[model samples]
Target: MTFDHYGIGHGFDRPGFGEAYFQAQGISAIHVMGRGDDWYQYADMDAAMATVRAATEGAVRVVTYGSSMGGYGALRFADAAGATDALALSPQYSLDPKVAAHERRWSQDFRRIRWRPDSNGPISCSARAVVVYDPIGPDRWHGERIAQDIACHLIRLPYTAHPVTTYLSDAGLLGPLIAGLLDGDFDPQAFRREARRNRSANGIYLGELAASQPRRRVATALSLARRALDVSPGNWHAQVSLARLLSQEGRHDEALSILAVLVQQSDRSLTYVVDLGNAFLHAGLTTEARAIADEVLSRAGDVAHLHAWAAHICWLNGDVADARRLIRRAVTLDAGNRVYLRAIIDYHFGAPYIAGVRGVRVTSWLRLARWMMKAPLRPEPAEAVRRPFPFRRRQDDSASDSAG
Candidate 1:
């Protein structure tokens, strides 16, 4: 079933995956698509359930399948719609916060869910429920809440994140797995064995493992990241993570060698170029680093991040005058931000850099002072910046904590 589509990732099939395979097996599938907080508790619930009843009238069994938010819906609606089995990948017991107080991963989505129609409560289904999860993944934290009342057959695929369906899709095993469950012939060991063999799954698992590790364990983390790159060399996320870890370990030359190719291949993505510049600067190649900043400034329209990166690089190369000018340009581009204003003050500027302003406005300076009072997450892996943080691109998708 399709979950809420508000913040979908790349390659997510809006209709759900696997039509040909399901048809080949003579298994007809019904996709229940939800908008916002309907939770499959859609306004047309009665009609939808009646439709399901009509469709499964003579069928031997019915299985409801979904992952993440869809998993949340499938399990909750399974019994209501007379399903004989539910295959929930990374199901949440609730987004209500009241029932699932310990859960915290998808708090943003949680606020979007309706409070009255709670999905965390005990389900009425008499059929078997199968929950596939990564025990160490954040999904497990939510999955366990429903386990207290429901006797679910758990298949732990550790290190697989919330999107276990991606792994299932890659392995071409979703149809077979569901068929097995419906036929009472489900084999967890065989299924796990088959799913683990998928190259995409391995790449995801290794990359996630490397990313989740602490920086203090740099050597081991680097080894895992390298393994991930071996599995999926074209994965940009792994490339950045490896380069950053390498740079952190003072192996800047190695980082530069790896990132140089990526910078050109990526068509000078600001993130890659910034990372490349960072590598060159750290590796005692300031001239090459400065050239990269100059190239970005020369080619593009007014991009706040490009100017920010150029400013940082200029400051490093003892071009304080250019650094001051670039910082002023960055601040001009993002006017409302007090963070940038304080940077101007830190640059020893008495007046606001804008030509029309009389001086650094007292009110703006006060706003900057207020901003300094709070501890904010920034210049770190977790902070998704628009301008040049020299890390991940904060695209129109969900941000990850360790995407750097």
Candidate 2:
């Protein structure tokens, strides 16, 4: 049976599962009715559950599923009817007091009952329950607290809008509900395991966002990372993740501030140091970035990626020769690393450096050439070239080659 806000009870008609859900689960003999009404009203949910319970003769196994306002109704029904199980998707714990206060202007029906959490009808079910919500919802905190209190399994679907029922067909949504029903246990441990698994599956959705145009959606990623931090303030991964996103958005100062707090509370982590360097580099503070890279290298000298970042700092500081040398070292340490190889190639063949050489207009490039001639190139078995050579040939070499 399906229910709606109106008092119309209609035969349930979800093409995929309305009948199949009952038939496959051995619930075919039971009668299903859709109770369409405001279940929050005093006599509404009580009357409906009474009818269903009586019809099923106390042997009924009621599984209630609801979304949005309907979700609230389902919970009320579960509490009153002693349902076998319940599932509420994107439910509001209570109507916002601000909205309820404006009931007169919005709708006359809104004023028919109190909408505060305290005034809402109590849930009285002994049945196991599941509450699914989107963390970005306006009532997210209220929903989370309610789920926590009831010990209902909470499934946080990332990037979902206000009501998640629209995603009823989503595999990530249906697969778990089916699994939970079959398992017949909804204890805390089970909930935790399911939550973790769901989080792993949700990672695919994040990968899609990461692959979006403009390279990154810093705002969306940072918002989710912030939500994770709010849920678990001590989550080090969330904090670092937020910092990384902030750095991508060019909010380096904010990223640095977050990292500063995180590093103080924890040991010197490699991720923290690398992120700090990135933040500094994005903020146009090459010297500060180099200092961080130096500190990281002191402890992790052989880490090729760290050396590559340090080379970038050197390049930004107008030490092109040193930048090239450090980049070459980084590449030698990790030959298969495309990131370091790209940096090396950039230093060697990038348009700016090549243009400076062709135009003969950059004093820094001339100085770099002189320094390169004096410094010995580090020998590498993989290197095709053996030694550093001058950019211009000597007058004697030109005359001798001409004569020959």
Candidate 3:
């Protein structure tokens, strides 16, 4: 069985993720279709689980597989679905803010649904959990949390960012890797060798590596970004990386050209549009930037990051009132994000930064300091694995999955 990432769903009307692939392979699988960005916390969850139990009741070797949000679901429902193996790629330990307060990337989706108590929490199951993640990325937090209480294999791909499967798939390693795990014969050392050898041509990895570099390595970053694009011309991340590098090098026109094409190719994806607007702003095209901001604000819905982008654009345009309003909305939607909170303080109190130092009022600085003091410390990257706990099963026990 296979699960899906957030926003990648084909909707409840279509077959769930990996249905076609599994079918083509002549494998019997049940897919759990998520209706929205609800993190599989369906109103009819009991009914869904009942259906899954019925479909997978007689399976002999069930394995639940997924990436990102789907990965979370695979682990969350493994025991209930009678799964023997749970293969999760970049899974979150929990999406509930109360449980994972350090996670802010999915605040928009988090705000879209009313979180139920204990719906999204740590993995609690008897199955063998195998998690694949980038040890240095945001997922490191979730991976560490999951490992703290449960036994699992942590497959670390450092600096690979969130999409572990994409990186593996690009290197032609995903199929063999998953096959080996399913067959219980995976050789980690050999797999690592192949992964390292193939990574030079992996576009997403190259783009991400470029973005992760410091500004002093701009030349190397640009080279990597160009190589990424050379290998995968349509890669959005690579295009964005190259554009940003160009902008930083004072090549505004080149950056704008890339961003303009990106905005068109992405069908006006808000992030890409915001990048274009920022590019224009940096190019001394205030009118164009303001126009883009107006369009974005009119159509921006509830995404916290989009509002934050609009707020920054507004602030740069000397529209302090709009900036304040927009940033307040962002902070409201994602209250746990310290960066947004700081932006709110800046916009609300007319304390815009000059030369990288905010002219913040003493009281405001004290309040910000208090919040910072309470923030959770991020864990450092390290190879981690927990020996699998013994799972007792009846002689006739069956295995099954609850795929997203």
Tell me the number of clashing residue pairs for each predicted model. Answer: 3, 5, 0
For candidate 1, list the clashing residue pairs, or say none.
Answer: 305-387, 305-388, 352-360
lDDT, candidate 3, at 195:
75
Ranking of predictions according to TM-score:
3, 1, 2
Which regions in candidate 2 have their CA more than 4 angstroms from the true location?
1-26, 29-44, 58-61, 96-122, 165-168, 172-176, 186-404
Best by TM-score: 3
lDDT per residue (tens digit) for residues 192-245 in model 3: 778777777778789889888888898898999999999888778778878988
**lDDT of all the models against the reference?**
0.66, 0.57, 0.76
Q: What lDDT tens digits, residue by residue, belong to model 1 across residues 1-404?
A: 22332233324354443445567778677766554433454467667767876877777788877777777766777876777888888777666767776655544445445565544577655667888877786677666766766788777777665567655654467768877987878887888777776644365677668777886887789888898788778766567768877887899877888898888789888668878877887777777889888977887536665676687677677777787778767665654344454555645433334324545455555655665565355554555534322123346523322111
Alpha-carbon error at 374 in model 2, in Å?
A: 88
Overall local distance difference test of candidate 1: 0.66
**Residue 254 error, candidate 1, Å:** 7.5
